[model samples]
Target: MAATLFPDNPDFIKRPPFETDELRRCLTNYLDTPFEFDPSGARPLVGNYRWGVYAFFDYDDEPIYVGQTNEQLRTRIRRHLTNQRTDAVAMSVLDPFEVHDIEVWPLPQFQDVDPKKDRTAAMAARLHLDALERRITAQAITNSQFKAILNEKDPPPGELTVEVPPSTRGCIVSDRVREIRGHPDFRIARRALIMSRLAQVISERQVKGGLRRVMLTQAKRLEWLAARRFEATGGARTVPQEGDQDGEE
Candidate 1:
């Protein structure tokens, strides 16, 4: 039997197998609505609109660690806490509230053998992730003092100090920890680290050229000092020093 064609319809010439006017209208509505895309402020645009991995060491679990890949971090972390999945790591860590101080890093792309594609983005992601893991591990090894500044409540008000072991190599500590703590999205952590590193490079260039630059370089150093003080006081607020103006210019 020959099917009747609607010659008057504009879409009849080459109709998709599952085309419908309702579907077209829905797509059109979605397209018309512009989305705000800020990777650091919101969720990642990849992995079903969420980043893929969550890696952390359990503070109370002695030596246990947790590393997971998921399309939704909140959902996965919730399941892990509630023992909803049999394969979930034991919830032997500290209470959920304690670990609520999370640091998320996004890996939009992974390693690939393709030669044509630019590998800079992927390499940057890997470097940031590796650094984060190393930092967390080092903190665990050195005790709670070396943990992320965000994990501390009511961070201090002055210069922060960090002691890096002589064996540590190619490690650059910046005010990224403060930015990540203020940032709501975990995926932006990696991006913030990368930006901090780039800013350092720019600052170095400016210094070498004898050009005056903004105060970001000084601000980063101050932030690091403030973070350390905050951690030492168990997240309590401290009176500002003679030179400190409550983060003011």
Candidate 2:
């Protein structure tokens, strides 16, 4: 997690961090990797029998959510990305339309584990993965300025890892201002993501829409949301407030 990514909560975690050299190394490596998430409009598919961890990154390629499973990497991941039949995405924990990319590490192969059905190996893998997820989530919180992630909840009580310092990892968000100043196109994509999210919310709320009044309440709220997000990173500048226009004769 980057320092400014999530909002902070003091009571979310307990102290005495655990040792997670592996988690630190994995997370840093993962962040540095270039990945294309679910691209096809069709359903998602995965066939790899790997117990592993995965994450959903937003348009700017920042992780918004993370999960681990000892099941087929395809089946579970499909549920998150391709299969909206499940409640996770529908519940808005992750906004499907705005998700920019996805990536997965074959944790089973990396850890030398077999299929998840094996009772003993699966148990060990699950425990390890739970702790692994906790370590990453904790490390992310430690480095975050807001201290909260949009992604996932922290793992329950267990052996905690030592607080990993904020990484100097190169990401799409790296050198944010320079990158934006250099490539202005990214700014448009960011705006689109925000608008897409608001659209989803408005639709979910069952708000009515028409030609002139096409979700105006939501449209206004979307503007506010976009302004705030951009303002946080200095993407927005002071502009004149939009005033109501009157019809002319």
Candidate 3:
């Protein structure tokens, strides 16, 4: 049957098949979420805080990376996810697509401390940030199903440690994005591709042992997801073709 051609409608807006824009909005909304500073709810956390620590979690709610920044958490996290400015992204140690949730600890106390002018105060604040990062990293490792995250290098061990502070956590993936990326098969394929790219990077350069460790962790994660999917599907049933002869060489 012949079909009639319709005139283009310029006034109609169409949504994209891919959810990139939706995901970006979800991330922005998550970052803009107000954190409860106290019982009175008078002070909400802002994104301009200078000293902060953050963590990224995957679709399965597994921690994938942890980092601290003396700069603004908003800037550092946006660079990691929206662009390749962060070393972790450049090295393929962290894939922004895999990040489904974020948790951040903002230390507003050091917002006014400038490293150039007050070196001592800045250094002290950095130590506290580092300590907080290390503690969070430990918790992530303990909570992870594989007992490891994708960070190429763990936060350096230190004698100093800080108490956990009030933090805000939120999902960054939109429902539309989840409809596609949240599928098990899609996730497995994406993880495998990232692992392959990371391996190729390692092979092409004189990389450190920490990078190698990341590769191993990726392998484990891939294997675990694959196995889980297989189990959930109860494996595929084998069938014989009617035209095929049994035991034919």
Could you give candidate 1's per-residue lDDT for residues 1-249 as a string of tens digits? 123455666555565323233233332332233223432455332213222334333222222233433244445544543333622222112222123223333333432322235466544544444444455444543553323221211212233333321110111112333243333233234324533544555556534221112123223433554565467665645556677656732
Stretches of candidate 2 exceeding 4 Å from the true structure: 1-47, 109-117, 142-145, 160-225, 228-249
**Full ranking by lDDT:** 3, 2, 1
TM-score: which candidate is best?
A: 3
lDDT of 3 at 108: 67
Q: Write the per-residue lDDT of candidate 3 for residues 92-170, one digit (tens) a residue.
A: 8899999999999888677789888999999899789889999999999999988988888878777897999888899
Instruction: Report lDDT (CA) for all predictions.
Output: 0.34, 0.48, 0.84
| Residue pairs of candidate 3 with colliding backbone atoms | none
Could you give candidate 2's per-residue lDDT for residues 137-158 as a string of tens digits? 6655464444444552445556
- Worst 10-residue stretch by lDDT in candidate 3? 1-10
Can you tell me which runs of candidate 3 are displaced by over 4 Å? 1-18, 38-42, 236-249
Off by over 4 Å in 1: 1-66, 83-94, 110-132, 139-143, 146-249
Displacement of residue 23 (Cα, Å) in model 1 is 38
